[model samples]
Target chain A: MFYLLGLGILCIAFLFIIGLYNLDFKYLFMISAPAEKITAAVIIIGILNCIISILFFFGVGYLREAVKAFMEKKIFQLKTVLYFKRSGIYLSSCATLGFISRSLAIIYLRVDNNGSGFGLGYSSLLIFMLICGLCFILISHVLKESVALKEENDLTI
Target chain B: MSIYINLDKVLEDRDMKSHELAEKIGITRANLSILKTGKAKAVRFSTLEAICEVLDCQPGDILEYKAD
Candidate 1:
């Protein structure tokens, strides 16, 4: 399941990059200056999104390994715990970076367009990323506590 | 740090093997090994009772406590 999700993210990221490259550069910018500046910003945000997706792939890979370890009945193993923690950190960082990049994109769009009614979807996306990052961090802490309890139980013959 | 297991001595006195005792007590050999090696943090009352019955002894013969 995780592998499939990672693959899907990769496909979407690739399609997004392709779509960006195919867009009319000057039309998207429309900033009355050298289109280079707007193009640069677009590329930066695109690259940032691509990087976030890559981080998600790593997180998913780690989650896959953690699940496999769980099935093997090694619930409290250090490796499983480390995998979960690393994945959590990766996912949280992905969401945070995504939020930051989108915030910058929204600011750039508003400033370039003279603040004329641009959609506020970016704000919702930022909130979503924040929530997702917090959930991953919370799950990681819960897994750590469970590991500690399991270790104690195992030792108590 | 205070408790001691004299399982080895009792098993030797009874002329019994570890596997034989484990079989009679209905526990895995690995678990019995853990108990014998003093690695177990705590033993269940049922397990202790089974071990005592098999060895023809009391719990005192298997476990002892000494202040560190």
Candidate 2:
């Protein structure tokens, strides 16, 4: 949760700094017009992301528990695998949506006849999205490895 | 990194089922299974204590030294 919150704050702060640097106050305000809308969308998406992250964390626990359960010939705990799969789905969608939103913002800036500043803003947003996308990919890989390890342990036991 | 668990042999010697041991030790069968399979990263002293108490044995009876 802290990581997500920190990332969100950092992204917003970076956007604000870029906006200030470009003096694209008008565009910023124009973007702000959709601020509530974008925020609403992000809020919904963020909530979903939160839920998914939580499920992912719990999925690890479940996987461990399931392995033990299976080894003892006890009840199979499917919750971990289910939660893990769902988290993967949710994470992918979130990343895609984030990329799309960033792309749309860049496109909006390109078409707008504001100033050269708009170009800078667009580039900054693009870079930000790229960084974020890379981070998410790395995170996904880490999660995948963890899940694989748990599965391997389950199989061996 | 290579702690060896002798839980299987202990259970065998005691003629106690894993589920029964788990119940006696106040842990879920799943957790006991983790311990038995050596998948657990760490074991609490309290849990070890419980297991020893239930099995009427020492920690060495359940765990062994294994140089990694």
When just chain B is superposed on the true chain B, each candidate scores a TM-score of 0.95, 0.93
Model 2: CA > 4 A from native: A1-121, A134-157
Give the clashing residue pairs of candidate 1, or none.
Answer: none
> Across residues A49-98, which tens digit of lDDT does each residue of candidate 1 receive?
67876886787678678768877887767787787777777767876786
Pairs with backbone N, CA or C atoms under 3 Å apart (clashes), candidate 2:
none
Best by TM-score: 1
Q: Compute the lDDT of residue A87 as modeled in candidate 1.
A: 73
TM-score of 2: 0.41
Q: Cα deviation in Å at residue A134, candidate 1?
A: 3.3
**Alpha-carbon lDDT, every model:** 0.69, 0.57
What are the per-residue Cα lDDT tens digits for candidate 2 across B1-68? 57899999988999999999888878788878888878887788898898888889999898898887
Q: In model 1, which runs have C-alpha deviations exceeding 4 angstroms?
A: A1-51, A68-76, A108-126, A152-156
Per-residue lDDT tens digits for candidate 2, residues A1-33, read 646755775666465345434533443454467
Q: Which ten residues in a row have the lowest lDDT in candidate 2 chain A?
A: A110-119
